[model samples]
Target: MKQRIITAVVALLFFIPLVAIGGMPLQLLAAAMAGVGVYELFNMKGLEIKSLEGVLAILASVLLVLPKATWFNFLPDTVTNITLFYLIVMFILMVPVFSKNSYTFDDAAFPVLVSLYVGFGFQNFILARESGVTVLMFALLVVWSTDIGAYFCGMKFGKNKLAPHISPNKTIEGALGGVICAVVVALVYLLVWPMANYNLLIMLPLTAIFSVVGQMGDLVQSAYKRHYGVKDSGNILPGHGGILDRFDSLLFVFPLMHLVGIF
Candidate 1:
C-alpha cells in the first residue's frame, strides 16, 4: 500500500506538469506511453519487443499517438495517417511470407491488433488534450474517481460479483458506487472549471455512462491479463502494474468522450 501511494505521487508529479504544458512535450509523452503500452501487450504474448513485429507495432502506435497536425507539416496531403498505418500492417503481414512461415500470420495478427487497440486509444488521448486541458482532465477525473470509488465501495458493500472470471474483486454494487462517485466528482469539476459546452444536466448522465465504459475497459484489460496468466501487465509502477494497466480506463473513456461530442 505504501509503495503504491509513493509511486502514484511520484508519477503524478512527473506527469501533471507535462499535461499542463500541452504541446510537443505532451505529444512526445503520449507517443512514448503508447510505445510502452505496445511493448507490454507484446510481452504478454511472449513476443520479443526487439523483434521486427514488435518494432513495427511500436512505430505504428507512436504514429497514431501524435495528432494529425504534427503530420501535416511532413506527410504529403495525399497520404494520410491511415494510409501509413495500413502500410505498416501490410509489412507485418508480409513478414511471415518472407520468413517461410516461421513467424506465422497468427503471430503477425497479435501485433497489428495490439497496435490498433493501443494506438487509437492513445490517439484519442491526444485529441482530448488538443480540445482543451479541461476536457482532458474531466476524462481523467471520471476514470480515477471510478477506480477509487469501486475499490472502497467493493470492500465495504460488495456482495455480488461483477465478473468472477475476469476480475473477481469487482462487484456490481461497487460498479454502481463508482458511477455515483464519478457523477459527483464530475459535477464538482464542472462547478470549478465550467466549460462553455457542458452544463450540469448534460454532464450528470454522461459521467455515469463514462464511468461504466471505463469499468468495462478495465475489465477488458483484466480479461486479457487473465488469458496471459499474469497478475499485472508489468512491474513498471510497483503497485500500479504497467502503463496499460493504469491507462486502460482512460483509453476507453477518451475515445468515448470524443464519440459523444464531449471533445
Candidate 2:
C-alpha cells in the first residue's frame, strides 16, 4: 500500500508536467511509449519477427500520428493502407523463400498489434488536444475514478468475480462501484465548469460505458501477463509496472472518446 502511494505520486509528478507542456513534448512522450510498447510486443517469447518488421511497426506508428497528406501535396495517399499492404504483398511474395521459420503468420500479428496499440490509441490524444484539454482531462479523470473506486469497493463489498480467469482481483460489485464513481466524477466536473460544444446528456452515459471499456482494457492486459507468466509488461515504471500498466485505461478511453466526439 505504501509503495503504491509512492509510485502514484512519482507518476503524477512526471505525467502532469509532460501533459502540461503539450505539443512536441507530448508527441515525444507518445513516440517513446509507442517505441517501447512495440519493442515489448515483439519480445514475446517464441515469437519470430522478420527483418523489416520493425521498420513497418515504426512506419505504421508515425503515419498514424503524422499530419495529413493534404498539407504537403507531395505526401502519399492511403498511407496506412499502403503500409499494411506492404505486409500482405511481402508475405505472399516471400513465402517460398523461407525453408524454415515457417511461422510467418504468427510473427505478422505483432506488427498489427503494435500498429493499432500505438497508432489508433495515441492518435486520440492528438485529437483530444485539438478539441480542448478538458476533454482529455475528463477522460483521464473518469478512468482514474474507475480504477480507484473499483479497488476500494472490491476490497470492501465485492462478491461476484468480474473475470476470474483473466483477473481474479476484479469483481462485478467492484465494476458497479467504478461506474458509480465515474458518474459522480463527471457530475462534479460538470458542476465545476460546464463543458461547452458537446452534448453532456449523451456524453455522460457514453463516458460511463467507456469507463467499463477501460476496465476491460485492464483485464485484457492482465490476461496477457497471465498468459506470458509475467507479473507486468516491464519494470520501467516502479510500482506502476510498465507504460502499459500506467496507461491501460487511457489507451482504451482515448479511442472511445474520439469515436464519441467527447475528445
Candidate 3:
C-alpha cells in the first residue's frame, strides 16, 4: 500500500506537468507510453522486444500516437499515418515467410492487433489533451473516480461477483458504486468549469455510460492478463503494474469521448 501511494505520487508529479503543457511534449509522452504499452503486451506473449515483429509493433503504435502536425512535417502529405501503419502491418505479416515459419502468422496476428489497440488508445489520449486540459482532465477524473469508488465499495458492500472468471475481486454492487461516483465527480467538475456547449442533463447520463465503458475496458485488460497467466501487466511501476495497467480505463474512455463528440 505504501509503495502504491509513493509510486502514484511520483507518477502524478511527472505526468501532470506534461499534461498541462499539452503540445509536442505531451504528444511525445503519449507516444513513448504507447511504445512501452506495446512492449508489455509483447512481453506477455513471451516475444522478445528486440525481435522484428516487436520493433514493427512499437513503431506502428508510435506512429499512431503522434499527431499529424508532427509527422507531416517530415513525410509527404501523400503518405498519411494510416498508410504508414498499413505498410508496417504488411511487413509484420510477411515476417513469417522470411523466418521460415519459425514466426507463424498466428504470432504476427498478436502484434498487429496489439499495435492497433494500444496505438489507437494512446492516439486518442493525445487527441483528448489537444482538445484542452479541461477536457482531458474531465475524462481522467471520471476514470479515476470509478476506480476508487469500485475498490472501496467492493470491499465494503460487495456481495455479488461482477465477473468471477475475469476479475474475481470486482462486484456488481461495486460497479454500480463506480458509476454513481463517476457521475457525481463529473457533475462537480462541470459545475466548476462548465463548457458552453454542454447540456447538464445529457452529460450526466453520458458520464454514467462512460463509467461503464471504462470498467469494461478494465475487465478486458484483466481478461488478457488472466489468459497470459500473469498477476499484473508488468512491474514498470513497482506497485501499479505497467503503463497499460494504469491507463487501461483512460485508453477506453478517451477514445469513446471523441466518438461521442465530447472532444
> What TM-score do all the candidates reach, one by one?
0.96, 0.84, 0.97
Clashing pairs in 1: none
- The residue-by-residue lDDT of candidate 3 on 132-232, one tens digit each, is 89988999999999999999999999999999999999999999999999999999999997755578898899999999999999999999999999998
Worst lDDT run of 10 residues, candidate 1, spans 67-76
Better of 2 and 3 by lDDT: 3
Whole-model lDDT for model 2 versus the true structure?
A: 0.72
What ranges in model 3 sit over 4 Å off? none
Q: Roughly what TM-score does model 1 have, to 2 decimal places?
A: 0.96
How much does candidate 3 score in TM-score? 0.97
Give lDDT tens digits, candidate 1, residues 101-172: 999988898999999999999889988888899989999999999999999999999999999989999999
Candidates in order have lDDT scores of 0.90, 0.72, 0.91
The Cα error of candidate 3 at residue 211, in Å, is: 0.5
**Judged by lDDT relative to the true structure, which candidate is superior, 1 or 2?**
1
lDDT of 2 by residue, 2-121 (tens): 887898898789877877776767766776776666555555443433546665676666556544542233646655434643554465335435736564666666676666776667
Task: Give all candidate RMSDs, comma-separated.
Answer: 1.3, 3.3, 1.2
